[model samples]
Target chain A: GAGVSQSPRYKVAKRGQDVALRCDPISGHVSLFWYQQALGQGPEFLTYFQNEAQLDKSGLPSDRFFAERPEGSVSTLKIQRTQQEDSAVYLCASSLSFTGGPLEQYFGPGTRLTVT
Target chain B: QQPVQSPQAVILREGEDAVINCSSSKALYSVHWYRQKHGEAPVFLMILLKGGEQKGHDKISASFNEKKQQSSLYLTASQLSCSGTYFCGTEMDSSYKLIFGSGTRLLVRP
Candidate 1:
């Protein structure tokens, strides 16, 4: 089976631009997650989805960041009016279960977004 | 809150051993360990549940202490392939979200 995958492996956007990153999770995965990793730092949680419902999104830095997973399979993270501080590697992960217990998550290669 | 990892970085020689620790301020339900090489996605290493079970494979192992809200990752007989940034993700009780540590950079030389 294929692991989690993200599109637009690299993107360069000018300040104030809007960019959408796509994530294709593993087949039959019930949980999807988005994270942001700054240079030399660990990944920080951004949002999580269970099926088609967004279960948690408190980690989003601001209103400019939005995410959706309408069909419970593929998900998208949109950043409106990108700022220089938004430049980072965006990672997507998926898990087979949503039991609120400890489950292994497989990660994607990530999308490196540079807001210049 | 995000967990704090000790010894921001460590250098090791092949066949040596090293330990990385993560401490969280909040009550934790589980802890996860991962290693990420440059220009690559993070690879999962191990997960330690609240019961204080120690899990491992190969030369890597981890221990979780529920009472202290802390976890430790042990890498024994290190190899050059173990060089990478190690991160510990802590999950609070019923939160289902993982808050990661700053990371511990490990360098192994032959």
Candidate 2:
């Protein structure tokens, strides 16, 4: 794809169920980020990855949330034992800068996760 | 900490102007601006890295004040296409992750 792409644009999961969202960043991009956005709010950072290294996960709300980029191109966000509060749009963004410097990020369509 | 944005919502007519502000409590390394419409992902508008630097494309522009840890987005001669939710993402000097503001909703009526 010419830009960032996410799979399963919409996912509905029952409480206590688990879900995984995938993100495929633009080719050759080195930095990927995951964010959660609630209704009428801005995106909150969840995690950050530089290439294949998971450098920062401080924004993750709890231990149940996990993310990985095994190949440095594609990334996945997994939430275990989902709760109602987990319902939100999960956004994926990628930047070409590898130094963790300032750069414009390209965002995906985002996967809307609905937990009931 | 999350940045704070003013004017939760605004309505503007064609050719009008609007300004959205984002303020943070901590020192920042950079500030980024993005716009997201209903059911769509955020589109990057511009990024300000240095203090007192102003940049713009077309009728939209932005300014960053590193000392006060604030940034403002300017929309001049607004068009219907400019109607959307605007967000400011802030990055601290010690981290690479972006902490975004609550957002400013702008409506442009023609």
User: How many steric overlaps does candidate 1 have?
Assistant: 0
Q: Identify the candidate with maximal DockQ.
A: 2
Per-residue lDDT over A60-91 for candidate 1, one digit per residue giving the tens place of the 0 to 100 score: 99999999999999999999999999999999
lDDT of 2 by residue, A1-116 (tens): 59999989999999999999999999999899999999999999999999999998988999999999998889999999999999999999999886746888999999999999
lDDT tens readout by residue for model 1, B2-107: 8999889999989999999999988888999999999899999988989889998999999998888899999999999999999999988756688889999999
State the lDDT of candidate 2 residue by residue for B1-110, as single tens digits: 89999889999999999999999999888999999999999999998985679999999999999888899999999999999999999988735688999999999998
Interface RMSD measured for model 2: 1.2
Report every candidate's CA lDDT.
0.94, 0.93
> Comparing to the true complex, what docking class would candidate 2 get?
high
| Deviating ranges (above 4 Å) for candidate 2 | none
